[model samples]
Target: MQSYVNVRHSAQGHPSGVSVLCVSSELCNRLGACHITMCGTGMQRCTLNVTLEQAMILSRNHGLMPRCIMQTMDIMRKQGPRVELSAKNLKVMDQMTPAFPRLFKLCLPPSDGDL
Candidate 1:
């Protein structure tokens, strides 16, 4: 999932330009990893184990921008269930907000197919 946050101006009304946040995953030989890329003011890239929660937290602390982080989390919260259920025998055990880091739980689907 990817989200972009455009900052047109700073508090002083100076042009600050735009920034982009991209989140993607790779699976190779049953080893999966997640990567985050930030581009605009500067560029940064990092790879980590496939724990999106941790990745988001790290990104938030890394100064990628809050709007970008929230947008990415919203996309994941909306699409996560479908992605989880597409597997042959997988189930969603719990739904938690990655942005707030366990502060809230999302309502679960009534059935796997219902999502």
Candidate 2:
């Protein structure tokens, strides 16, 4: 028996698909180790090709400006992260906020309390 791994892609820089091959022992011996065969039908991966105009309309429906989206994506690529607060800190703050109502209430002065 013979097995082969194939890397496939379209000439336009898109995914073509993935395929597997299995051969009989006799054919494998005849073909030797290196064998090339055309990929069978239904090998291409499913894809959706949308034009720029259609994409823009879709973006509009989603309330996104194409230019702003592009800029935001670029900024994301440059920045390590968008939010500074750590998840631990956020969780701690959430827990403490409910547990210490008096601490938060201290921000407002009591009418009869000492200055």
What would the TM-scores of all predictions be? 0.22, 0.18
Q: For residues 1-115, write the lDDT of model 2, one tens digit per residue.
A: 0112233568998744432322222244356653333222211211111122223334445665555543443344345222222333467434423343453355445677664
Compared with the true structure, what per-residue lDDT tens digits does model 1 show for residues 28-89?
21255533333332111111122244445556456656456556545655565434533322
Model 1 pairs in collision: none
Number of backbone collisions per candidate: 0, 0
| Clashing residue pairs for model 2 | none
CA-lDDT, candidates in order: 0.39, 0.35
